[model samples]
Target: MSFIARTSLALSAPNRIVETAGRSLAYRRFGTGPDLVLCVRLRGTMDSWDPLFLDVLARHFTVTVFDYSGLGLSTGTASYGKREMARDVDDLVSALGLTRVIIGGWSLGGFAAQTFAALHPHKVSHVLAIGTMPPGPMLKPPEPLFLETATKLSNTVADEYILFFEPDSAASRALGDASMARIAARTEPRDHPTPPEVFLRSLQASIEPSGPFPDPDDAYARFYRNTDIPVLALSGDHDIMFPVENWYALNDLWPTLFVVTLPDSGHGPQHQYPEMSAEIIASFVRHTAAR
Candidate 1:
């Protein structure tokens, strides 16, 4: 399907639910090629993704987007740790009968994607970590202002702009606005907003530092270093949450790691530059699969 075609479908795609791990997990599937399961960011539902971005990805792959258990339309208790979240993804994938798939995660989802690859390397064909930091001590803490703003129960458009877009650039702000509009386009059957308590729990699980790395060389060598799967890590150069330098440092350690930095973007590079992000992801998936 073409990007436009997929975008249209994604805007109207029905939300599907599957019973996995004794809970009903809400998910959406689009596109028509190899399976690509995308994990949602912290406290975000499947509807949190931008339609334009989803459409671009759906055009080239079978894109699967879903909410974590107990969040959005999904039913069950939520898990805070990345490993537990990864297990939930494994259950969802197995419930769908997908044997081998590429997994992509954004933000906290990126953490889950990395854990999933590390824990279930045989089942995952490749890993795409976007706007994420590597696991362990080497990962930098997010700015205090970003964290404080993000934790607010209700965020205005201006607040969202601070979190997702580069504040100094009007073009980036415009993209952020457009992305929010696309995110809001899915009107009917919308997901239930994540409760404040659940949101806090999940957020804490993701940001709490994983410290006590005795070996300097292995500070960031927990999951990604152990997995042989082809890995692609992308982030905006101006990402305030997880800086682009983190990925560069990661690549320095693991030379095989593929890293891309989108110019002038903040945390949400995919939202800021959907077309470029989609192209990079699609091309990488194709090239890696061929290998």
Candidate 2:
């Protein structure tokens, strides 16, 4: 829990605490106007999110960002899976009495956000899926690498994973192998790696009976269909995680489904271009709400 709440001089934002999802989830609410839920990537907490980015979002809507259970400060048995996490989002909204929210997510978090909306369409007024894809072999080349890393890192602490998201600072990049060596020293949790059962449960929830979803070739059209709500997908051209090709394929399926790419951005642009990104999604929500 210290990772989510224990603040250092680096943290610039205040927090609003709440007990939801059966945990004392530390949520941060900003933007005094409409409601928006920021579904963070896997194993994230509100604090790990960049405050500068969130502050920008707060300017337009009352954004709700919380820790997913079993990560950071959120407490519970460390059982992991998308269904449970998606359910947590449902529980969070219901507990807060919010009937409508523009649910958005990043990476694995984005996948779950879309799934939550698809499963509970009535609750999600709008959807924004950033840096995600339908599950399958069609995903980016780096996905398999990421899976390998995830399987190896379940017992690791969040700090060790920071380099995956952080930009290559000149000072650090200049150091080359030495830089990664320093980053690698960040420790994994000593308790234990997540058990195979937890991983299996997560996999079952993420993929359908046949395989992973959106089927890349038809993701955009598919995601936009069966619901009248607006949808957007933001990605990066260099995203090795689920490379730009995946999103390009989605766009081909639904040419009208708006999409954007951030220059030099990898998987997390909300942190890199918070205000502009927030504006993009908030505008769509407002437009849809007016309609």
Candidate 3:
């Protein structure tokens, strides 16, 4: 075989191990038992989470994860926003024949999960929200450095880089430069979440732009109200993306909200403190179930 053939074989080999979502998603499931669906954030794919951490969660219960619409293995464009993406989650559950789910979303995904639970309370068994906030500018703006980094990276990375390549390493694939509109069309579909070209289009919009931008789904409400299901909201102590103070706002919205604060972590506590994250989740699930 030619050299190109050899290279293609090697790359596909690693990915071959991953399962497909028929025509609707490209997701992987590990372990078995009750269902726990992990929702990815805006501009996020499954790669945003660490494999070792997934393994830990898998040990306790079945875990299902997929690239959100327009982002990862699911086929589509990448620039979609909150309401559309939330629809994607509902479609994903229906497509996968998931009748009941413990929906967990981090960052944007976390907000999405709450939104989903609020929108479809019967389908959602419980909710786990992490490091997330509503749309629109903050009452108090983010710290200068954090805002600077976010704006800089948004413009530079081609696409949002959840797990950016190291300075010494080669840059991420070319798809990071996909356009905003193209990315927006990637809803959870009947198959792979996004076509690779669409992924590339989303990359284009990641770069910092000079004008107006879309906000996350929840711009008006601090917390989703009047839900009866169990809820767990966690925020990292040092997270600049969504400061821990947001938890207080969340608590105000839902008086009985279960809140946990990680002492020394950043925006992605699940990735940064997997053991703690997992244990906390397990406890929440058990406590929720017992109630």
Stretches of candidate 2 exceeding 4 Å from the true structure: 1-24, 135-139, 143-223, 289-291
| Residue 195 Cα positional deviation in candidate 2, in Å, after optimal superposition | 13
**Residue pairs clashing, model 2:** 1-73, 31-58, 134-213, 135-213, 156-188
Candidate 3 TM-score over all chains jointly: 0.68
Q: What clash count goes with each model?
A: 0, 5, 40
Every model: Cα RMSD to truth: 3.1, 6.6, 9.4
Better of 1 and 3 by lDDT: 1
RMSD over all Cα atoms, model 1:
3.1
Could you say which candidate leads in lDDT?
1
TM-score of 1: 0.91
Model 2 per-residue lDDT tens digits across residues 135-229: 34454456464555545534343322322333343322233233233323323321122345655455545554433453444443365544566
Q: Candidates' TM-scores?
A: 0.91, 0.70, 0.68
Question: What does candidate 3's lDDT look like per residue over 1-291, in tens digits?
Answer: 333233321112222122224334566566566788888754566555544455567767778777665455555545545555567678778777789899888876775676677677788777888777543335434455544454332344421333221122132222222212223322322233344455445545542242112345343344345556777877766566666675666566664478888765556666555567887888888777413
